[model samples]
Target: MKNLLVILFSQALVNNFMLARILGTCPFIGVSQQVETATGMSLAVVFVMTMASAISWLVQHLILNPLNMGYLQTVAFILVIAALVQLIEMLLKKNSPGLYKALGIYLPLITTNCAVLGVAIVNIGAGYSFVESAVSGAAGGLGWGLAIIVFAAIRERQQLAPIPKAMQGFPLALVTTGLLAMAFLGFSGFNVAKFVGM
Candidate 1:
């Protein structure tokens, strides 16, 4: 339990996919115009990331290792992630047309979102078991969700805040993202494992 908690904290905050590790910047900026869309995207990412990690872990240990085809990890993981994203896309389109439309190209882009792949690779590299890999992936997704939602809120508010014309869009968003990344950096080397009694 302590180990799980530590991993959760470390991945979600200390090693945030967006803020700290600097992965998945496309949707972080593109889908962040509105909190509603960002939240939708976040939930989709969380589900996909969690499932992808779990499935990829199984493939790595059960198939790749047994066949001594470890070199195919990236290709295997990509296929897995792509398949999972397609399933999600279908489900969302059938059940939630509003959010499905809101997500636009970003939904498919989740497959290419390096953060999803990064978490899976990190899980294998870290030698985390199935449960740990799932947790790490979920945490990574939650971290991404948190960052995008917060950023979306700020950007929405910025509409009314009278900002200088030069620093209106991307410039301000970049500045905000940099500051958020710096803030997450404060968690660096904080010894979360020690605190969690790991």
Candidate 2:
């Protein structure tokens, strides 16, 4: 339980997806002009990451590890994530038209989100248990969601504020990301392994 808490906090705040990991910068800059869009993207990313991690974990432990086929790990995991995202997109379209509309084409882009793949690879590298992997995956998603939402909020507000012509849009968003990354550096001392007696 304590270890779980540590992983959650570490991923969600100490090492955020955007602020710390620097993953998924495309959407972070391209579609984050609005809070609603940011939130929708975040949720889609969360679902993808969680499912990808779980599926990847199962593949690694049950199929890859047993068959000694670790070389195909990346290919297998990516395939699974892609298929899962498609399924999710279909489910959302069928069950919740409003959410599907809000998500729009972003659901398909989840396949390319490095953050989702990062979580799956990280789980394997960290040698996390099933529960730990799930926790970390969710935490990664939460961290991503929080970072994008915060960034979107800031950028939205910044639109009305004065700014140099040269430092607008992409440039300004990059600067914001760099500063946020520096802030997250303050949590580097947090150690989940130590706290959990690993």
lDDT of 2 by residue, 9-82 (tens): 89888888778888878767766888988887888788888888888999999999999999999999889889
Off by over 4 Å in 2: 95-102, 191-198
User: Which residue ranges in model 1 land beyond 4 Å of their true spot?
Assistant: none
TM per candidate: 0.97, 0.90
Residue pairs clashing, model 2: none
- Which candidate leads the pack in TM-score? 1
- State residue 33's C-alpha deviation in candidate 1, in Å: 0.5
lDDT of 2 at 11: 88
lDDT of 2 at 191: 77
Q: What digit string (tens of lDDT, one per residue) describes model 1 on residues 1-198? A: 888899899999899999988899998999999999999999999998999999999999999999999999999999999999999999999999999999999999999999999999999999999999999999999989999999999899999899999999999999999988888899897899899876
Report every candidate's CA lDDT: 0.94, 0.86
Model 1 weakest 10-residue run by lDDT: 189-198
